[model samples]
Target: MENTATRLADIHANIARACKQARRKPEDVTLIAVSKTHEAPAIQPLIDAGQRVFGENRVQEAQGKWPALREAHPDIALHLIGQLQSNKAEEAVALFDAIHSLDRPSLLTALARAMDKAGRQVPCFVQVNIGDEAQKGGCPISELPAFLAEARAAAIPLAGLMCIPPADTEAAPFFAYLAKLAADNGVAGGLSMGMSGDYETAVMLGATHVRVGSALFGVRG
Candidate 1:
C-alpha cells in the first residue's frame, strides 16, 4: 500500500514537472488510473492512497466490479477508455463519467439516444486515428470535421479529442496533431492522449487528461 502511494506521488510529480515546462497548471491535468483487468483487491490500494479516478476497457467488466466499489467509495469517477459497442451505449452512459472511445456516427447516435433516455450526458472524447492504423479504433483524420459536426448535431457533449499513436513511433507529433485538430475544429473537454509510457510527452503537448495503467499499478500481469 505504501509503495503504491509512493508510485502515485512519483507520477504526480512527473506530471507537475511536465505541466510546469509547458506553462500549464498541474490542476489542469486529470490522471485516470487505468484499472482494466485489475481486480478489486489490486485497486483498493490505490484508492486507499487517495486515487479517485479510474478507467476501464469494457462495459461488462466495469459493471461487474465498480458497483460494489462505488458502494464503498462514491467519489470515484469511471472512464470508458476502450472500444464501445453501439448496443452497449446506454449501459456505457449509465456506468461511466466519461466515454473516451466515441469513434463513429453510429455510436454517437446510439449514445445520444441513450443519454436522453438515461438523462445523463456523459462527456465524450472523439477518438482520432492519429496513426491512421486500420487495426485501431479511432475515426480517420480525414473524417474528423464531418464527424464532429455530426456529434454536435446529435447533441453529444464533446470532450475534446483522444488518440493512441502508432506503437514504437515518437508520439509527440501525433499528440500535437490531435491538439491542432481540436483547435481547428472547435472541439471542446480537452485532449485525452498519453499513456504510462509517453504521458509526460502527452502532457507537454497539451493533453488535459492522461490515462495511466502500469505506471500506477505496475505492469498488468
Candidate 2:
C-alpha cells in the first residue's frame, strides 16, 4: 500500500512537472492507470491512493472484475483501451465509462446501436493506426477523415483520438502527429495517447489522457 501510494505520488509529480514545462494544466490531463490483468486486491491500494480512472484491455477480463470494484468506488471511471470486437459492443457499452479503441465502421455501428438500446452515450476516442502497423488496431491514417464523419453520423460521442505508437521507437513524433490529426479534423475532445514509458512526453505533446500500466502496477509476472 505504501509503495502504491508513493508511486502514485511520483507519477502525479512527474505529470505536474511535464504540464508545467508544456504550459498546460495538470487537471486538463487525465491519468488513466491501466489496470488490465491486475486483480482487485492489487487495485484497491491505488483506489485508496485516490487514483480514480482506470483502463482495461479486454471486455471479458474487465467484466470478470470491474463490477464489484465499481460498486465500492462508484466514482472510478473505467475505460476500454483494448481492441473491441463488434460482438461485444453491447457489453462494452454497459461496462465501460469510455471507449478508447473505436476503430472500424462495423464496431462503430454496433456501439451506436448498443447506446441507443441502453440509452447511454459513452464517449469514444477513435484509435488511429498512427504507425500504420498491420497488427495494430486503429483506423488507417487515410481513412480517419471519412471514419470520423461516419462516427459522427452514427452519433458516437467523440472524445478525441487515441493511438499506440510502434514499440521500440521514440513516441514523440507519433504523439505530435496524432495531435495534428486531431487538430486538422476539428476533433475538440481530449487526446488519448501515451502509456507508462512516454506518458510525460505525451502530456508535453498535448495528450489529454495517458494510459499507464506497468509503471503503476510494477512488472507483471
Candidate 3:
C-alpha cells in the first residue's frame, strides 16, 4: 500500500490535472479528506504530510478523535460533512470550522442560536437534495428559496451549497444543475460536491470543494 504522503501527493496531482482540464487554478478547489470511521493514529501520517482539511460524519465521533489531534495540529480545519442534529448545534459550533449539512429550517435555527451563543460564526453549506432521494437529508429543491432566506435571516454565514448526486448514476447533470442553483441563489462561496469517484467531473462542472475518501485513504475497511 502507498504511504500517506505518497497517496496525498497523488491526490494533489489528480486535483492539479483536473484543474488544468477545467482551465481553473488548483488553489480554487479545496480538498476535504473524509476521515470518518478512520482512527486517529491512522490520520497522523496525513497530517504529518501537511493535509490540513478533514471531514467528519458525526459530531460525537469528531469530538472523540479531534480534540487531541487539533491540540497537536492547531492549523487543521475540521469540517462537518454529515447530517447535523439540532441538539448538537452548540457542540458543532464549538468544534467545526465549517459545516456542509445545513439542510433544514430547524437546523438553521439551532445553528444560528449556537453561533450567537458561542460568539463565533462558522461558514455553512446548505445541502440540496438535488436527486430528491427519500433517504437523503437535504432541503428539497422547491424549498430552497424559503430555506435559504431563513438561513440568511438568522445570520448564519453561507458557504454556497452542497449535494450528493445519486450513487452509481451519471453525476454531471446534477453537478451542472447544482451550479446553476448556486448562481441563481447568489451564492458567492464554494460548491461542496462530488466524492472520491467523481470529483474530477465535479470540478469541471464548478464544484469548488471535493470530499474525497477512499481515493486518498483507500477503501473504508
Error of 2 at 111 (Å): 0.4
lDDT of 3: 0.94
Ten contiguous residues with the weakest lDDT in model 2: 1-10
**Model 3 poorest ten-residue lDDT run:** 212-221
lDDT of 2 by residue, 120-212 (tens): 999999999999999899999999999999999888999999999999999999999999999999999789999989999999999999999
- Model 2: how far is 81 from its true place, Å? 0.2
Candidate 2 local Cα displacement, residue 179, angstroms:
0.4
lDDT scores in order = 0.95, 0.95, 0.94
Q: Write the per-residue lDDT of candidate 1 for residues 65-129, one digit (tens) a residue.
A: 99999999999999999999999998999999999999998899999999999999899999999
TM-score of each: 0.98, 0.98, 0.98
lDDT of 3 at 117: 97
Once fitted onto the true fold, the runs of candidate 3 whose alpha carbons sit more than 4 angstroms away are: none
